[model samples]
Target: MASSSSLLSEEQFLCPICLDVFTRPVSTPCGHNFCMSCITSYWDNASFSQCPVCKEQFQRRPDLKVNTFISELASQLVSLQTSYCDHSRVLVLFCRDDNTLLCDVCSSSCHARHNVVPVQRAYERMKDELENTEAKVQQMIQERFHKVQSMTESVKQTAERQADGFVSDMQREIKELQRTAVKLRELKQTTDQLRFLQSYSSTSLLPHTMDLSTVSANKHLEMQHFGKSLRKSASQLRVSLDEMNTEISRFSGGTAESDAATLRYMQQYEVNIVLDPDSAHPMLCLSNDGKQVRYNMGAGMWAGQFLNPNMFTSHLAVLGRRGFSSGRFYFEVCTGQKTEWCVGVATASIQRRGPLVRSSCCGLWAIWFLIDKFETFICPGVPVHMGKVGRVGVFVDYDKGEISFYDVENATPIYSFTECSFTEELFPYFNPCDNEFGSNLEPLTIVPVCHVE
Candidate 1:
C-alpha cells in the first residue's frame, strides 16, 4: 500500500476541469480524463467542444464514458492525501496577512516578510473572532426584531383603547336617551290625567301643547359636539400612523438596510409634495398629475388662463402646493438629465413679476444651473462644481433657520444656508428654465424616495 501511494501523486488524479480530484471520471476522445460535471459545465460556457488539457478540437461532440479504473485510483488518493497539505506540501505555519496556510518552503518563498504564526494559534484566534461576530450580529437582529414587534403591539393597543372609548361614549349616549324617554312617558301620563280632570271640572287646566325644546335642545348639541371631537381625534391619529408607515418603508430591506441609518434619519421629516399649478408661469407646462413641470415654447400664447394676476408674468417658476412655516420638512426633485433648472425653497412673498433678483436677499434660497454650471443663488452666487446630479434633496428647518441641499444619487452634500431668520411660510420653488434651443425641455420630475434593495 505504501509503495502504491508513493507512486500515485496528487497531480495524477487532479482533474484539469475542476483543479481537484476527479469525480465520476470520464475519458474524452483525446484520451484525457475529467470530472463529468466539470467538463460538461466547461463546454456549456465554451463556444467549441475540445479537450481542456490537450487543446484538441472535436468536429462532432465526443462521446465520453466513465473511466472506472481511474475513478477508483482517485478515491484512494484523496483519502491518502488528507494528512498532507495540498497532497505534497505540509502546512506548518499560517500567514496572518493573507490568512492562508503555508508550508516551510511556502513560508520562505511567498510569506517571507509576513507575520507567520503556528497553524493552531491562528485557527484558535480566527475561531474566537468568528464566534464573537456571530453573537454580535444575532444580538443586533434580536433588538431590531423586538423593536418592530413592540411598535406593532403598540398600534394594536392604541386601536383597542380607541375602540373602548367609542363604545363607552355610545353607551353613555344610549343611557341618556333612555332617561329622556322615561321622562317623556311620565309627561304624557300627567297630560292625560290633567285633560280628563279639565273635561270633568269644565275648566282649562294645561297649556295648548307641551314644549319639547327644553329636553331635546341640550341633547342635540351634546351629540353634535361628540361626533366632531371624535372625528378630529381619529383624523389626527390616522395622520400619525401614516407618517410612521412612510418612515418604515424608507428602509425596508436589502441595500436600503445598508443605507438605513441615513435614509431613516431623513425620512423623519419627509413631506409629500405636489406642484401648485396656480403658481406656475404661463410658459411653463404642468403635467396632469401635477408632479412634473417643463418649459413649453408654445405655452406663452395660451392666454386663456394666463390672465390671472398671481401667475408668474415673466419668470419661469412654480411653488409647491403646501407651505411650511414651522418645524422641519424634506422633499426630493429629479432634474431628469436636464442641465438647466432651478430648485429650492422660497418665501411665499417673493417678487414674481418683471425683472426680479434670484438671491437670498430677494427671498429665494436656491441652487441653480446657470451657463452649464451649478451654483447657489445667494447674493454673489457661489459656484458649485459637481458631477451630474439626477436627483436633488432639499431639507429645511424653519425654526433653526437652516436650508440644505444634497446630491441624492451620490449621497453627498451640495450646499446649505443657516442663521437667517424666516419670517413667512416657505414653499418648494421650481424653475425649469426656458428651453434653450430645445435642449433643456425635459420636465423637472418630483421623484418619490427610491428605496434600494
Candidate 2:
C-alpha cells in the first residue's frame, strides 16, 4: 500500500469528471477514466459507438477490466467528520442588522433586525409568500416554455423546407421540445421561493402609535377631555350594541317593531363637470339621502392631461387604505400651451386657496374639498387598472372640449356631452392612450364585471 503522503501529485491523479481522486479507475478503449455508472450512462443510448473522451471509433464493446491499485488507495482516504457546538447546534438566531432570523449566533449578532426562533412555528406563518413566489415562478416558466416550444416549431418548419425527410424528424423533436418546456417551467417555480427565507426569518409586527401634537396644544387638551367624556359612555355603548343586535335579528326574522319600510342606500353628493369657457350654469340633482345639490360633479368627473413626461394616465384614486378613512381634499389643474404640461397631486384645499378665476392659455379647474380628493387626471394614451372600486362613469364635454361627470358611480352613461350642453358620468375611471393628440380629450369607463379581484 502506498503511503497517503506518497501518492504522487494529487492534482494529476484527479479524475476531471468527479473532481476527486478516482475511486475505481477503468480505462476506456481510448484511455479515459470514469466511474462505471458515469461511462455506461454516457454510451447507453448512442447508436454510433465512439470513445466519449478521445472520439475513437469502436466497432464493438471491448472487454472491461477493473484497475484495483487506484480503488484500494481511494478506500484509505477516509471521509472527514465534524460536530456542532453544544450551545447552539440548532439555534434560531434573530439578526439585528436585517431584522431577520439566523440559524447561528454569529449571524444574530451582526444582523440587528434578526429575531431568533427557537421553534419551527416561528417560520410556519411566513411560508405563504414562499409558496406564492414558487407558484409565480412556475407560472412564468410555463409562459416561457410555451414561447420556446412555439419558436422551436417555427424554426423546425423553416429548416424542414430545405432538408428532405426533415419534416418527420421535426415532428419527432416537437414532443421532446414540449417536455423540455414543462421542465423549464418547473425549474423557475421552485427557484423563486428563495425570498421566503428572509420574510419569515425577520418578520416583526410592531404596534402603531401617533402623538396628539397635530392641532394646537389648547385644542389637543380640549380633545383629550372630550375623549374622556366619550370613554365614560362605554357602558352605555355596550347597552346600545345589545339593542342594535336585537333590531338586526328582528329585521332578519321578518318582524317589525312598529312599521316596516325599507330604505334605499343614499348618495351624500351628486356631481357634474364641464369645460365651458363661456357661461354655463351648474345643474342641481337630488342625492340618495333625498338631498339636492346645484352642481355636484360625480366621482366620474376627470380631466386628461400630461401628468408625467411619458404621460401615463393613472386614475383618480380616492386615497386611504381601502379608502376607509379618506375625506375630501382640493385639486389644481394646470393646462399646457404646447399641450405638454404637468399635473401633480396636491390637497384639494390647495386649489381652493387660489381665487377661482380663468387665467391664460394655462387653464386650471378644481372641485373644492366636498368629497375625497379624486385623482382625476388622464394621459393621452395610457391604460389603467383601477383596483377594487369597480366600474366608474365620466362625462365628456365634446363641444367645450373638456371631460365632465354627471352621474354617480357605476353609471351607465346617464348623460352625454351633447352639442349644445349635455354631459355624462361614470365611476372608477381610467383612460389609456397609445399616442398623443392635440386637444384629444377623452373619457374612460371600466366594465364592472371585469373587476375580478
TM-score to native of every candidate shown: 0.43, 0.18
Please identify model 1 stretches exceeding 4 Å from their true place.
Answer: 1-264, 302-306
lDDT of each model, Cα atoms only? 0.64, 0.30
Candidate 1 residue-wise lDDT, 216-273, digit = tens: 2222232323444444444544443333333232222223222333443464588898
RMSD of 2: 32.8
Q: How many residue pairs collide in each prediction? A: 1, 52
- State the local distance difference test value for candidate 1: 0.64
TM-score of 2: 0.18
lDDT tens digits by residue: candidate 2, 346-424: 2222122213232211122212110112322322222222211212223222223323222122221112111222122
Report the number of the highest-lDDT candidate.
Answer: 1
Give the lDDT of residue 156 in candidate 2: 20
TM-score of model number 1: 0.43
